[model samples]
Target: MIRFICCLILLSISTLVSAEEKLLHADFRHRPPEMIVENNRAAGPLKDVLDEAADVIGYKIEWRIAPFARSLKGLKNGKVDLVPRVIKTSQREKFIDFLGPIGHRQKDIVFLVRKGKEKTINDYHDLYKFEIGIKRDTAYFTKFDADQALHKILLLDDRNMSSMFAAHRFDVMVVLDKDSIESAFKQKDFTDYAYADYKHKQNIGIFYGLSKLSANTKVNAELSRILLDMSQSGRVAQIYQNYKLEAPLRLF
Candidate 1:
């Protein structure tokens, strides 16, 4: 009886130690080769850093994978605890706590059109005459849609939106320069196409979306320390490099 009790006590202590560790939930919606789903697994630069960050912090991660809308809902309802990459916006501040930035300030939108229509998009002023594809409800799209000067907007989901661009269904599509380049590269096409400037420059910050708890402030401070240490020691760069991503943009 004494030996059995000792074994039980040790097991209980082990469980207690594990329960004290934190769990971070991470999610992303972009498709491959940037954010690819393969053999029931997600892989890319974002996932690489997230996995490393969780390991570094001694925390386990419960990953959520879905379309953009579903992932946003997960973050809002507290169904998930973290989002690997999100562009910080004033409206989103109410829901998520952020970590270090993973991408940079994308200054201009690259306009992709059918092969022969390159000359049509000369500048932002030319946008008024063309039908442009924009992802509805995204921070950048929302800001762009609200401006009275830019009219004739056509909204679509990112996947369908990209398909339309490739099919020549639209004259021009406004997308982030990096994302446009990434998409073309993923399709194994390296050719450049028509593009023009979108005056508004956005600062994209990739962060962990912590659940709102009474202990949130304390949680953020702790997470920040882990991220800062990762940044200073080049752990962040190493993780991104492993997945073939550029070193993360420093916002904080």
Candidate 2:
């Protein structure tokens, strides 16, 4: 009886340790190639590399889905622990700590229009002609984001973007990744769509934005160091390679 009681005590201690395991919260909204959701779990290059880094640093991740704005707000107020694919904006840098750039800022941003409407959106000035579908609380670029004259429909993160386009919900879709839109286009048999020709070739990158208020802040240097080492060791590139994407070269 005493041996059985001791065994129960050991089991209880193990369960307690498991329950106390440290977990960092991260925002997960599906953006393909860079960030993807497969079978209700986060996948893709960004999540992969981050996952590896966190595991090495003895941490687990708890992913939550929220609107882009709310995600940023969570980062600012310490509700969220990390946000991937974030550009370093002046206002955001004040509250969030960027690990480093993973991919070029303009490398993926694209504006898509329905067949025959591509010619109508050849330049930024022509955006005023119709309403555009834009994700809420997303930053595309400085001038475009700050423009108040354009008519934009604020879209939620969970909405069906392809179905909305098929239904003609808006005239344009500003996407962060070309592969995501292309995959959606192929899946919906909506291959007739074309890109709007306003060229934005900014070579800066988006980053892994860590929250200032989270316990993860304590391991900021260690995490950043591991990430830098990963980037240099080609592990970051290898992760991107699994998704058939190119890893950014300039990480500093």
Candidate 3:
């Protein structure tokens, strides 16, 4: 009877361990003065958020530094267990489930033109007045294509797009707000360009993206519970503070 009881306890422990299998992966990018890492370890606000979430859930994490396009492919292929951030859309719902949204909607695309020139456009009607720079295959442009107001929008690769704007091939260009701001600060010549804030307004919530491979309902529920608990206990705030990011806008 003693041996049988001991075996039962061991089996229960094994089950618990198996349930908490190592199942997290993250991507890396340069966000400057914010998140930077030498190897796979994190040293920024993004890393702090991911680490805190992992600690709360009792899960392990693996890191992969790759281009944005490659990282998306990795997530879709299950080569990546988690994507640190992404916009949740209906199209993506078919292949993955979003765990929770932890970040704000900060990724808005902006329309840029020469600083002193009256080249900025506001509405869709204004957009048709000039050639607009947009990325190929991005959802932003996909929406633009669907909109009747932007029928004259021009799609260009980054090099040709930005160069055309510099050369005045297009009177205006639409670029991500964050990227445009960062680029203006980094590039001296681009200083002459200014982005009008109202052309494309998209509120995108950044979520802890999960692949179908890690879509077990039980694990997802546990993760959600952990996140909510962290939010209530101020652990999430602590992590944000550690990285000098503004504390979460809302705990809920």
Instruction: Estimate TM-scores for all models.
Output: 0.74, 0.83, 0.71
lDDT of 2 at 194: 81
Pairwise TM-score winner, candidates 1 and 2: 2
**Candidate 3 lDDT over residue span 148-188, tens digit each:** 66644455345456665666676676675455345534554
Which residue pairs collide, candidate 3? none
Worst window of 10 by summed lDDT in candidate 1: 210-219
1-252: candidate 1 lDDT, tens digit per residue: 999999999999999988886676667665544466666677886677666766766777677667666666777787766766666666777876776654454444466665566677676677788777766555564556566776545554566665666666666777654563456445645343555543445555556566453232355666666766777777877876777767756655
Residues forming the 10-long window of minimal summed lDDT in candidate 3: 179-188
RMSD of 1: 4.4
Q: List the residue pairs that clash in candidate 1.
A: 99-207
Put down candidate 2 lDDT per residue, 1-252, tens digits, no spaces. Answer: 999999999999999999879899999766776787767777778888888899998898888765577888899899899988887888788888888655454464578888777678777788888788887777778887888898888776424666787788777888766776677678777776788877565666657899878766997888878887888788888888887887777445
**lDDT (Cα) of model 2:** 0.78
Candidate lDDT (C-alpha), each:
0.63, 0.78, 0.62
**Model 1 backbone overlap count:** 1
What stretches of model 1 exceed 4 Å from their correct place? 1-22, 31-34, 102-107, 141-145, 148-156, 177-203, 211-218
Clashes of each: 1, 0, 0
